[model samples]
Each structure stands twice: as structure tokens, then as C-alpha cells.
Target: MEKKKNLLLDIDEVFCFPGFLDAINEFLESNYVLDDFSDYYIDEAVIPQERFNEFNKFLDSRNLYENAQILPYAKEVLKELDFIYNIYPCSSCINPFNIIGSGRLFADKYNFLISTIPFIEPEHFIFTNAKYLFKADIQIDDRLSNLNENIETCILFPSYHNKTISNDELIKRGILRAGYDWRTGWLEVANILLDQSQIKDDKIKRYLKK
Candidate 1:
């Protein structure tokens, strides 16, 4: 029998929307700083140390861990996928502190918030600078540039940050074949993966019943 393929899912933006910059702008405004950091989108291609530090400060100061909101349908999608495939939560950290300390802190906070959800596990998590190190069959992420063509499948979850890259451009670059921006799309992803998983289990039955 062939081994089961693993599905790697990104946490931030993909599952939880960390309102880090937004929260910073709110805090700044309350403190009388008129500057709006709301328009700031972390540029994935560029790694500016100063800008990174500023971003980290924003996360640290505001206690952003509790503020992170799980995207709509994210829980349902994860539950559905878990029934069929080996699901792994994979996320990349921007700041050095995030990779070392902040990452674990954020994970702990996230797990606490979503503790009501029984299927989500902390041990199945991975924090890394290079996501490619994990040999996954599929990776679902919001950034198009991070997609590795050598991987089996890369699903792009559209976001405001990636406005410059058109869907056609993504396909042309061989980054992704299909993209989605809402929970409905996430459900479709679950259905696709579940249909592929050969496991005959109660979870699969429950999802099918729905």
C-alpha cells in the first residue's frame, strides 16, 4: 500500500488573521500618533531589518496573540481535512524573535484560544524560516511567491497583500492552479483532500453526512 500524502496548511492569514498592524494603528491613534500603519502590508520579497523590528514591536506591545481571529470556515475546513489526510500546520516567522521565542508564544496563545476545538493539536505544528524543508504533498498559503513548483500542489489563498500578482500571472509562473479568498473555497479544499484520502473512518462519514 502507498503511504498517505501530507497536507501543509499555513496558520496566519490562511487560518488566523493576525490583526497585528491594525492593532498597532489603533494603539498608536489612542496614543495620539496620527500615522496610519493600516496600509502597510509586510512585503514578502523584501527583508528590511528596521521595518521588521517595527512590526515585531507592534505585535509585542499590543499583545496581538489574543487578538488573532480564526478565518471563517477555517475550523470546519481543518476538521474535514483531518479526517482524511495527515494535516500539518506550517507557518513562517518574519522576525528572529518570532522564530526563536515569539513563535512559540504565539502558538501557545493560539492553542489556548482555540482549545474548544478538539481536533487541532499543538504537536503537529511547525515553525520555520524555510517551509520547503517539510516535504508536503500540498501547501495552502496566501503568498504566491512562496509556492514551490517542485511540490505536488500549491493552493493560493488570495489576500489584499498579493494584489499586484494577478491569478493569470500566478498560473503563468507555475505557482498555483486554483485560488480562493473565502471559507467556501476552503471547504472546497477540504472536500478535494478528503475525497483523495482513502481512510474509511467516522470523521469522513460525518463530513459526508453534512
Candidate 2:
């Protein structure tokens, strides 16, 4: 076997959809959805500055991270990718814009994976803003800011908030987007990143790697 490929997978938007945004919409009782993520920082994009206190309260009261719905194709895709890639649940627990007064944001995310994808070892979980620190063949994330020039292939997970980013800009940054059709996009990711030599073995791969 060749060297084990490193794949950095983001949790918040990539696998765990709507995360804090879902909680905020429910707490404010607003119809705002993920598409409303026009601004990079969710604070400026979604909630008003005045509502920060209530936002903190909402996060404190509910285990949003633990309860947030998993994105479609996430479970099956990750399991499939595991055969060809060392999956790392790379995510940032603390919101940079929000003060994060309530510690639930950090702890809940950790437990969220424990409950959701228990197959991914806890040691592979990373929660930090320093995404560039992780060495990987490819990094999948929704936010472009988390990526850098180092990672070989930075696959931008398309979302409502990031629809406006132009293709030229993404190419300039050496980022690849699989369009908004995430289910197909994920399969494409597995195909593109999976080692080509494993053609015969890929077919025989089981859902749960033994």
C-alpha cells in the first residue's frame, strides 16, 4: 500500500448542516435559512448585534451542536471515504465573531460526533481555528477562509451562504467546488481523491471497514 492519504473533513457545514444557524433561527423565531449566510462571519450575516445576549442564552439553554441534523450523504460518504482516506473531523468550536460566553459551543460539538459518527476515533477530532496546521492531501470545508495555499486540494463544500463566490476566485485560490448538488458532489469527491490503483479493491470495499 502507498502512504495513507490524509483527508481533513469539516464538521459544521460539511457534515453537520445548519449547526448554530439552526439554533439562532429557532431562538429568534425567524425563517432565515442557511442561504442567508451572505457574510463570512455569521454574526454580521444573521443576527443583529443587539440580539447577542439572547443568542448567547439560546446556545446556553439548548445542546444545538448535539441536536443539529446531520447533512444528507454525510454518514454514508464518510464511511465510504474511510477506506481511501484518513478522515479527520476538523472543525472550529468557538465562533470567532461571537464571544462564546457559553461554553456549550465547544463541548457540545465534541459530544455531537461521539453520538453521531462514533466510528471516527476521538483522536482524529480537531477543534481549532488553525486549519492550516493539519497536514492533509485534501481538506473539505464550507468556509473558504479556513483554507490556505498549502493543502493539495481544497474542496469547497457549496452552501446557501457561499453561493455568490465566483468560480474565478475559487480557481485563483486553488479551491474546487462541486456545485450545490452536494450528494453528487460528495461521490465526485470520493472518486477524485480515492487512489486510482484501488479500482478492483474499491468495488469490494464494505460499508464498515473491518
Candidate 3:
């Protein structure tokens, strides 16, 4: 048997929508929008000091995560990916300033995953800002910084915030390899990783239950 490839999947923007950026604008009454996200760091990408502080407070809300909605095709595609890849729903719990949330966000994230994608067990879930530190064959994340060169295959997940970035610029920035941009929709990613294993593995429980 071939050793399975470990695929690290980012949770926030990829799995859910209106990500932190919109959440920021919604909670703080800031005018920041997706196009405003130019930097890898939100502080630089959107607002500075005061509003950034407010955003941090919003992250601490359990109700926010609990009420959050899943992105289009997220549940179905993830169920398919779960059948084929060693799916690890990785997320960043620690902030850029090395500040961790008050544990409420962590629980909220956990509960969200379990309730949303119940098939993804708690063991496969990872909460870490240092995603590069984790060993994986392929990684799918929304941030350019999150996709490290060390990962054998890095696929950047696109969202409203990152849609403006051109494929050429992504390659030029050294974030994505050549010929690897503009094809990261969930089903596209599913085909790239699972065409060879479309037949669900017998060991794990199947999603469709046919």
C-alpha cells in the first residue's frame, strides 16, 4: 500500500465564508472590505491599533463562531476530501503578537468543526499558527504566507480577500509554484487530490452511504 499523503487544510476562509475581514467590519462597524486586504497581516491589511484591538475582542466571542455559516460546497467537498486525503483542518489560534485567545475561541472552533463536518474527528483537527512546522505532503490555505515552500504541494485557497492577487504575482512573490495558480476551488482541489482515489477507501466510513 502506498503511504497516504497528509494534506493540511486551513479552516477559516477555506471552510467558512465572510472570514475574519468581514467579521471585523461587521463587528467593529469598520469600512474594511475584501479588496482592502493587501498584506498577509490583518493589522496592516485593514485597520491599525484601535480597530485591530476591537477585532481581537470579536474573536473571543463563542456566539460568533457558533452562528457562523459554512462556505458554498464546503461540507460536500470536505466530505469527499475526507475520503481520499489525510485531512487535517488546521487553523491559527495564536495571534501575530503571540497572544492566544481566552480559550473560548478554541472551543468554539472545535464545536464548529464537529457540528459542521462531523466525520472529521477531533484528533485530526489542529490549532496552530505555525502551520509550516507541521509535516504534510500538501497544504491548502487562504494566506500566501501559510503556504510554505517546504510543503511538497501548496495550493492557495481563494476568497474575496485574495481574489485580487494575480497568478503571476503569486508566483513572483514565491508563494505559489508556477502553473499552480487559479485552480483552487474546492471541487477543483478535490479532483487534483482525489481523481486517483475516487473510489472511497473501505477502511473509513463513506460519506454518501450508498
Candidate 4:
């Protein structure tokens, strides 16, 4: 039997829609949605520099994933992908604002993934910001910078921050965009990876080569 490929899958924005934005809204008493900001760091975009520390204080007092909901089709598609790829849920859990207490996130996210996705072994969980270190057959992440070149297939899972990225940029870097809408990104990913025949097709093949 052929060995399953290694898949480095991102947790936040990819597997689960984290509640950071919601938290920001709650803290500021302002209703700001995904489309409100194009920056990956929503707090920086919405909150003033003077209020940054206070925002950090607010984040420190709560579990960021408390309201996080798994992205649509994430579990179903991941379960199917698990049959062909070893799913490693890699996440960057550090709360940069509260670096000293960032360890709290590790446990919070770990428990969340364990309770939500029972199919993946706990040993496969990776919590690190240095994603470039992991050499896998496929790397799916919302952050374009996190998609390392060494990986055979690099999929940029669309998020608010990456919406402005041009197709030319992705094609030049041999990366594929799952789609622009985070609501249906997982389904798009399933289409791209589910069929082996599609991998060798001109579009996928063209991007994978470079």
C-alpha cells in the first residue's frame, strides 16, 4: 500500500474560525466583521496604538478559542483527506501581546483540537510559529509567508489578510489559493486535493512545479 502523504494543516483561520475578531468587537463594544480590515492582525488595524496594551489585557483574561467555531466542512473534508494524508494540525498559539502567558493558549487550543477532531492522534499536533521548519508533502495555511517553498504542494487558505494577493503572485511562488471566501475554503480545498488525477492536470501541475 502507498504511504499517506504528510499534510501540515493550520488551525486558526483554516481549521477553525478563531474568535479573536469577536473578542475585539466585545472589548471595544464595536461590531467589526472580517471585511472591516484587510490586515492579518485585526487588533492592530482597528484598535488605536494607545489602547493596544488594554486590548492585550483583555485578551489575557479570556480564552481566545472559547467562541471559536470549526470552519464549514473542515471536519468532513479533513476526515476524507486523512485517508490519503497524515493530517498534522499545526498552529501558532502564542498571544504575542501576552508572550509570558502565551502558554495558556497551547493548552486551550490543544484541548479544543483533541475534543473536536478525534480522528487525528494527539501526537501529530504541532504548536509552533516556525512553520517553515516542517517539511511536508502539503502545507495548507491562511498566511502566505507560512507556506514554505520546500513543500510539494502549498495551498494558501484564503483569509481577510490574503484577499488582496494576486493570482500572479501565487503562480509565481507555486502556490494555490483555496478560494477567496473563508466560508467555503475547505470545500474548495477538498476539490483541489481529493482527486489524484487533478494534481497532475495543467493548472495544479504548473503551480506545483515552481
Candidate 5:
């Protein structure tokens, strides 16, 4: 049997559509004064520990875990790609303290993904600050900043954060490719990898066809 190619996938916006900032804004709109809170990505220290507790509790109450929706083409594409590559689900939760405030919290969240996403074993899930440690052949992630030039990386344009930056800018800067939103972007990734793999297969088939 041939060894499968390694493919790393990001969660959150990639598979599940939580609207990360949107959800937080909704929580703030209900309880806090939004007067001067223009920047959603505020430093973790800026938020009083009490307010952070409330936010975390709200997230857990909503059962954000169960509410996660698989991206439009994710399920189908994973089914096809599994035939050729080992699909590993990798994700990073900003500020480890946001969940349960320690390494244990990270472990619990990783376990949640393993239970939720079928075909994804707990061993394949990784929750870390440094994504490059995994050493995969390719990685598909939505955050452009996370792109590592050394690897074959695919930068996925996030739906909520469509800033002025273009995918071309990311590639020129060093990313392999930048795709549009998750739904269609994932399919394009699967096709591109498959096509590359097909080229090798085609060469072998040429002599047989003759």
C-alpha cells in the first residue's frame, strides 16, 4: 500500500462557521457598553478578568461545540481527499485562557473536535500556538499571517475578515495560494492537490495506454 500524503486542516472558520468576532460582539452588545470598543481584537489584558469569565460562560452555555456547522464542501471534499492523503485537523484557540485558562483546557477542546468530527482521530488533532511543529506536507488555513513559506501552504480568505489585502499579495509575500471563502475554497484546494497527484499517475498510465 502507498503512504498517504499529509494534509493539515484548520477548524473554527474553516469547518465550523462560528463568526468568532460576531459572536463576541453579540455578547458585549447585551451586557457591556460598546461606546469606544471599535477594535474587536482587543488585548486579552484589557478585558477585566470578571468580564472574561462572563464571556466564557456565555460561550459554553450556547453549546458552541454542538452548534458548529461543517463547511459546505468540507464533508464531500474530505471524503474524496481521504483516498489520497492523511487529513489532520489542526486548530489554535487564541489565548489559551479564554477556554479554561490552562493547558488542560486546550486538551479538552481538542478532545471535543475528535468526538464531533468523524474519521478524525484524537491523535490527529493538535491545539498549539506554533503550527509549524506538526511538519505536514501542506496546510490549509484561513489566517494569512499563519502562512509559513517553507511549507506548501494554502491561505484561505476568511468571510468575515475581508480586509484590503488580496490573495496575490499573500502569495507574492510567500504563501503558496490564497483561496476565497471556506465553502468553495476548500473544494479548490482538494482539486489542486488531486490534480498534482494525477500528473504522476498519468505518466505511468501513458505506457499502459499505448
Candidate 6:
């Protein structure tokens, strides 16, 4: 049997969409969506500088991943990919607001992944803010900065904050752009990693729905 290549998969925006934005909306009582911010950190973008501490306090008191939305096709595609690649779900669990209580996030995120992706081994989970420290055959992540150059295939997953990254920038860095839209980005990713010829048109069409 051929050795399956190592794939470092980011858990947060790449697959599991955290409820930070929802928390922000409820806290501020402002109907802000993902498209409302150019900044990577949504709280930093909308929260007033003066009330930042209060906002952090609000966040610190809640589990953001308690109701995190699992991105469409994340489970299905990842399970497919797992047959060909060893997937390691890497995530940054630090709460910049409450570093002292960051350990709780580790448990929260771990339980989420464990319950959701039973295919992936619990031992394969990696929690750290510094992702560049790891090297693998492929790395998929929402933040361009977190995609390590050492990885053979660095796929930049589409997100609201990273929409500004041009194809030229990605090409310059030898990274692949998953797609412009996050809704169906997984289909684009499936085309990249899976055998394109085998991907049924119907399968692609099902996920393209708005």
C-alpha cells in the first residue's frame, strides 16, 4: 500500500465556522455579517476601542464554539480526502481576551472536533497559535499567514477577510487559491485534491446552491 501524504487541516474558518461574529452581533445589537469586515478579527473591526475590554469580557464568559456552524461539505469532503491523505486537524485555541482561561477553549474545540469528525484520530489534533512550526505535504487554512511555506501544497481557503488576496499574490507565494466564495469553496477544493474526472456534475451542483 502506498503511504498516505500528511495533510494539515485548519479547523476554525477552514471547516468549523466559530460563532464569534454572532456573539458580536448579539453583544452590539448590530446586524453585522461576515461581509461587514475587512479585518481578520471581526471584534477588532467593529467593537469600539473603549469598549474592547467589555466586549472581551462578554466573549470570555461564553463558549464561541458551543454553536459553531460546520461549513458545508467539510465532513463529506474531508472523509473522502482521508482515504488518500492523513488529516491532522490543527487549530489555534487561544482566547486573546482571556489567555488565563484559554485552556477551556482547548477542551471546547477538542470535544467539537471529536464529536464531529470521528474519522480523524483524536491524537492527531494539534492546538497552537503558531502553525508555521509544522511541516506537511499539504496545508489548508483560511489565514494566508498560517499557511507554512514548507508545505508542498498550501491551499488558501476563502474567507471574508482574505478576499482581498489576489491570485497574483497567491501565485507569487506558490500557494493555491481555493476560490473566491466560501459557500462553495469546498467544491473547488474537492476539484483540486480529488480526481476531477470522477467528480460528478450533480455532486458539484448540489453544493452550489445559495
Over the stretch 1-210, how does candidate 4's per-residue lDDT look in tens digits? 988899999999899977888888998899988877898888888899999998888888787778798888788778778878999999998887789989889988998888899999999999998998999999999999999988989999988889999999999999999989998787788778876443433433333322
Alpha-carbon lDDT of model 5: 0.59
**lDDT of model 4 at position 87:** 91
Candidate 2: stretches off by over 4 Å: 97-102, 182-184, 195-210
TM-score per prediction, in order, is 0.69, 0.82, 0.73, 0.91, 0.68, 0.92
RMSD of each: 6.0, 4.2, 5.7, 5.2, 7.3, 2.9
Best by TM-score: 6
- When summed lDDT is taken over every stretch of 10 residues in candidate 4, the lowest stretch is 201-210
Give the clashing residue pairs of candidate 6, or none.
none
Candidate 6 weakest lDDT stretch, 10 residues: 201-210
Deviation (Å) of 137 in candidate 4: 0.2
Instruction: Compute the lDDT of residue 180 as modeled in candidate 4.
Output: 97
Provide backbone clash counts, one per model. Answer: 0, 0, 0, 0, 0, 0
Per-residue lDDT tens digits for candidate 2, residues 62-82, read 776656767765776677677
Model 3 agreement with the true structure over 110-187: per-residue lDDT tens digits: 887888888987899999878878889888888777887787778777754566668787676555431232333655
Q: By lDDT, rank the candidates, best first.
A: 4, 6, 2, 3, 1, 5
> lDDT (0-100) at residue 7 of candidate 4?
97
Error of 3 at 200 (Å): 8.0
- Candidate 1 global TM-score: 0.69
- Candidate 4: misplaced stretches above 4 Å? 196-210
Error of 5 at 138 (Å): 0.6
Sort every candidate by TM-score, greatest first. 6, 4, 2, 3, 1, 5
Residues 1-210, model 1: lDDT tens digits:
557568888777777766654564563453322122222253322335556666556556544556667766677667766765677777765555554446555555455445734675667777665886777888887766566667777887755455456667777766663244444446555555556343354543444423
Measured on C-alpha atoms, candidate 4 has an lDDT of: 0.86
**Runs in model 1 lying further than 4 Å from the true structure:** 30-58, 94-117, 177-180, 191-210
